[model samples]
Target: MDAPTVSRDFDVVVIGGGHAGAEAALAAARVGARTACVVIDPAAIGRMSCNPAIGGIAKGQLVREVDALGGAMGQVTDVAGIQFRMLNTRKGPAVRSPRAQCDRVVYNREMARRVVEAPGVEVVAGEAIELLVEPGASGGSRVRGVRLGDGSEVLAPAVVLTTGTFLGGRLFAGEWEEAGGRMGEAGAARLSRSLLALGLELGRHKTGTPPRLCRHSIDFDRLEVQLGDDPPQPFSFRTGRLDIEQLPCWITRTNAETHRIIARHADRSPMYRGRITGVGPRYCPSVEDKVMRFADRDAHLIFLEPEGRDLDDIYPNGISTSLPPEVQEEFVRTVPGLEGARILRHGYAVEYDFLKTHQIRADLQVAGVDGLYAAGQINGTSGYEEAAAQGLMAGANAARAAQGHGPFVLDRASSYIGVMIDDLCRVNPDEPYRMFTSRAEFRLLLRSDNADRRLTPIAEELGLVSAEDGERTGRKERRIRAAVERLRSVRQGERTLEELLRRPEVEIDDPAIAAALEELGLAADEASEVEAEVKYAGYVARQAAQVDRMRRLEARSIPAGFDAASIRGLSNEARDRIARRKPLTVGEASRLPGVTPADVQVLLAALSGGR
Candidate 1:
């Protein structure tokens, strides 16, 4: 033995230091596989590239999934969040979500610390030039390792490419075009070419951030103070019920004057003037797009948020721009809340190379190659919450694959994480995908409150969650069942949890639990539980039936090496997609839009005939 081959090799090697890579490398390590994170800078690990915060609207569910599986994002958000708000309280459980504004410095520090402290992870700073592939059986490519620019070869059984905004990343604002990723960092120039060389379909996407304004220069008296919840809620279930010191945020609006200024400078705007080359997110548009699209609206809400407790930087949430400096200053001055606010950094849009999500499976594994995966913005998704969720799933599955275990997939009814992944695999968004409440077909069953209820068991199977998490799931499940039983057992005319939740006037307690402790307080807890379960009980049951039906089809697995071309009735697109994708089950096959029900029947017929 020549001293055990001097080069360090691991079971999984995660590329990129953003949200996805941090979660992916950490998950694989936590699941007991040796993991290495190849990054550009150690200080920037888990950096919030677009914004310095976590959890909002539909995104909160993704954070919850990370928490349920023992990932670090939830913990970091809980610790560093400055302002915490639960949105859509008037809506049902599925639509209700928790949003937080974090001190950016604290958030990144917390995440980086967790990644370094993880059991089986090593973080190295460098750039991967290309991948090394060896020919496996039947013409499939087996990944050997990644070669870095510094001339070091990192070997592993598997590779997860989370090259967010680094694959030939280019930025354009008006006449200016630069070679960089986010924050003027050196990007992966050759890695995108290397991936395309491996025959993956790549696309381009652009996203922008608002210029950071000096906190001291802003007129605080003009803005409305929006404080965090009285009793703040933490994103991580692992965090004990209480914490010290909650942070507050301010809210303001961009008036007609502000919109007019942005419109006047629209010629200089990169988005409309055709200076930027890639598609931007639809939901989050630049000030120019918002003004152009909603001309009738007089004002748009803008949130004044702190980047971190230590830094003087503040993120102006609603006014993402790629305008010139003079135009930005004029527009900032026109806004009701931001008058005389001095800009610290210029807001600009970055265009980066991305993959058409169909190139990878829901588990983030790439086609035509064993032990190769992708996640985060690389997979054509936006937002840190979205990236972290994808990374967690990919990391756990990669770990399971290394252990010779099954792939970890959480279905749509189970978690918003499932809906996000499924949408990536099935819906194939035309633009950069961001999570919205409308994305899920079975959202009624997937709520932020119950992420552990739906996904902790599966996470346990993947060994991403500790054995103790099983108890968290059990306690919640028991409480849910107890409430349901009491609902069914109670007599008519007398108030029940279901009855109380439906009544506008009758709350958890008709007397309201806080004041009327003398009477049976069980009704309040009962109402809370029933409100969660019964909000869309009918819709949830329907989705459950669909899931059950799909699982039955999934259970009837075709043997490995089964060919899709041999099956009849598959449409040309379906046949081509299935052949390239090699989906694991009939259910997965059915999820692909081009693959029809008839194709599934044909596959069933082919498998039965061979049997």
Candidate 2:
């Protein structure tokens, strides 16, 4: 498809200027491609609509990956954040996460400013109405450009659709409903219609956000205060240290009085009644739903979190509800900390149109469509972190696909990005999906602190990060290698690197390694990497061996056109999954929800054309 005028208007055009779009545009542009971002409303750029925070549990792992690959979430969050806390201090390194509360306004501005300043990136404010698909000689439609709301259009080889919750979005609270995507913004009326016309199958998903209370009005004296860790960790590897002063979050519990009050308004709740059609997230249940379902339970913990420093709003984390205004007011006053609390913003649930991600391939591209990628809330996922993670992966993969290469898929057992992509493309969810530590089977080797080590090589291969990022990671690796060798060589009363690390008492900043590493010409930062390597040596080695085994399966070709159903011994689940997911490799097939050991053996048989 040769262009008549200004051939190849841009290399990639990212729609929706949220986490995913930002990452997509940045990755494409960073890779030396002319990139453009089309956002519906520039005012909403990088808006932290639900929570004024980022990174939690496995979600923090993704943020570091974004930072390692030169995405801006971590760097921006670090600067604009008012509070920083490293969660799960008592837990192992794999489960540890860094969370922070930010001034939402500042976060949006900083993210926008960085993206606009990035080389080869352009920002446009408008709604993308339809995708332009030019046909190939073989006959499937190939994406050529996208049409905007104002009857204008731009051509690009690739288009990443990171449309968050704007597709047929409806907000509900009690019996009242609104037409906007969010309470304040308008929905994307044309985009979803165009998708349906393009034969894209879509599903409905819902997520509820709790109400914000005026912090000054709350009785903080009645609640316990939760503070951040003394020595905090930053989300991005590129960022040096997190030294932000922390804000205190209050904790209170809802008593039987609160439960009874909510119970009386159960029917008025949009969830219990037939008002809402989309499936709500199971983990973040609404207040009315919680009270009715957990009838035996006496109380539920509520975290009173500040929206940001000098802000009056305190977000009621555990009290998400869509109850009537009167009932909400009544139940709110019953909680210990919120006895005199006033609602700054009412809690409401959103029902938005999302693509059932099983329809998307591991690259985040549509199976039959060329250069069309979708990410974020549209992918049937919940939480800002989950959406941002998917957005970045989709953006990176779309850019790769446009370059005539295969999808940029990171294999599972190596990075959280791999686990997330695999899960989204394979598992069929009945509700909005959120990432939990329990979701990843191999999380022991994929800690948030070591994301740069896990993905720097692949990121370099993808041409997203500069050589400096890779060199930094490589130098760190050399330090680890040298220490590993030194440990192997020194086996006397003098402590080995690995042995010293195993003694939790021997710190990473110990003088012995610092002197030895200095003598070996390694920098202090590089020495720290060696320290982590020595500390987690046993677990890392075991995981690497497992990764090697998985790589074999990942490479074991399941032929492009293999038919699993015809195989004599294949189980129904295997056959159905094989037909549905069409996993590019046996490794991917194994990662699907229910393909058993026997199923793998049968799949191998089928891969040989069922001879």
Candidate 3:
């Protein structure tokens, strides 16, 4: 005697409503797909489980690209942000990025509202216990939908898994362990087995957060106050102004004593105790890792960030740990301003299952499984921005696949999203993958200020952007072109205005350049973009030529199921690697590990019927 299974239908079914799932569902619905987002709790959609902030370093460029593609992250960040600052202001335009401190609760609520109000999207409360699969036309497995914990099914042609850290998640602090993604939320215990049953390879990754401090307990007088910019820049291109009241974040440092205490009790940490086998993010290491790796440094800077305008908890940006509660308290008290701080919640590490990147195609579709996609932490990425970008692409591609359309793929030259996906597909990261400006070879063309210029037209053609937004982008482009043309035409005593801009001393706001730009009625952002283009025109052209050369290789398609064993002169290592990766293009095959330049030349010769 079992309960009857209640079956429902949707064009696309998205599992987990975190940052990735929310974007997936929204993007699917935006493309006119009947989408359903299944989550353990509907209220947790877009929850900032790690930090109460969005966009930092290379991450800000990602948010702008997501916005240009009509994704909700940048707009939602603009609405929920409490403080905004443009990082790397003194550096060149290529590395300058926007960061925003947000109200965590408000961000979650606003993102959930967007998902709920989105047409053709239904938010369903349930844990996905199993993936419903059927025999594919090619005698392989294909995902048909998902089976919820209640023995009900949401049937769809496509399924997207943006499970974050919830799939077989285990939280650890000292000797205590629990089956949960976050502190209070339960993990999807059964989902990992379902993926394993499909013959998908899974790897483990660990990430930790710092303890939240009771704001009233901290001594504000001892801290060095860091204020937001006077005219804070917005993350979203559509956001006209930031009218919210900005708050100040404070900084303190961990002294030698703090490091000593952590070193003394390091064995109590789950990671140190040999209880956690997963590899964590190397860029954002835990406190114990930091101390052990950089023992030469006696102090590490910590920023005390506000969680929200109405909340009393402060998030310490640095010193994330999984030490025992008492040790956490003891080490935290050694810091300058936190001498008497009360821990609202103790930090802990969570280890979860993620699919090996090589199993997914460029469009995020599972290589051997049809109608199945994965994004977010499930794909071994670390940040919310990376997750959202993948989710947008996955959801849009899923919808298109369901409508009998070809896959929509982005190249590394187009945007950061493209760069990230290219890296993920070409290389299997051993640790959690995080975005950085250095990761892109053509970073000069991938600046944060010009994401809209780089990607808006493609998004509009894909039906991800509104006609009005598309027209706005077109108008901005025209103005920039006209301004550049005018600069080239207007000559100074010895050089044109464009030539003056190329000089290191002359800025966009210089008297002569400012007057000329003002005549064209260009906004501050547009004028700045013009300046960057004029200044780096030569470098940009060189990179564009490199991109063109790469595109020629990418255009040479590698037929599916093509056997590398037939190609003579390939090294055994290259043959084995190519066979396992199954690269879809000659360009991808060239980028695979162990596949040398000689190997690429051999591959080209074999494909072209040459020696």
Error of 2 at 589 (Å): 3.7
Q: Give me the overall lDDT of model 2.
A: 0.79
Indicate which candidate wins on TM-score.
Answer: 3
Error of 3 at 525 (Å): 1.0
lDDT of 3 by residue, 1-611 (tens): 15637889999999989988999999999888999999999989999998878998999999999999999999999988889999998999999999999999999999999998999999999999999999986456889999999989999999999999998999998889999989899999799999999999999999999999999999999889999987888898899988878999999999999999999999999998899999999999999999988999989999999999999989999989999999999999999989999999999999999999989888899877889999888999998999999999999999989888777778888888988988998777899999999999899999998999888898898889898889999999999999999899888899999999999999998898887777789988898899999999999999999999988888777776678987889999899888877777788888887999899999998888786
Q: In candidate 3, how many Å is residue 536 off?
A: 0.7
List the lowest-lDDT window of 10 residues for candidate 3.
1-10
Per-candidate local distance difference test: 0.80, 0.79, 0.91
As for candidate 1, its clashing pairs are 104-307
Put down candidate 1 lDDT per residue, 1-611, tens digits, no spaces: 12222356888889987899999999999888899999988788888876787888889888888888888898888888877778787766677788888888888888888887888999977888888799865487878788887767789878888888888887755566788887668878899888888887888899988889999999888779888886877778787754657766888888888888888888888777776768889999988789889999999888888888778998999888888888888889988767879999888888888989877776778878788888999999998989998998888888778878777777766778877887888755778999987887777777788777778887777678888988877876776676566655553467655655555555444443323333233333234555666545666778889878867876776556878876666688888888877777777788887877877887777778842
Give me candidate 3's TM-score against the actual structure. Answer: 0.97
TM-score of 1: 0.94
Poorest 10 consecutive residues of model 1 by lDDT? 512-521
lDDT of 2 at 185: 88
Displacement of residue 97 (Cα, Å) in model 2 is: 1.5
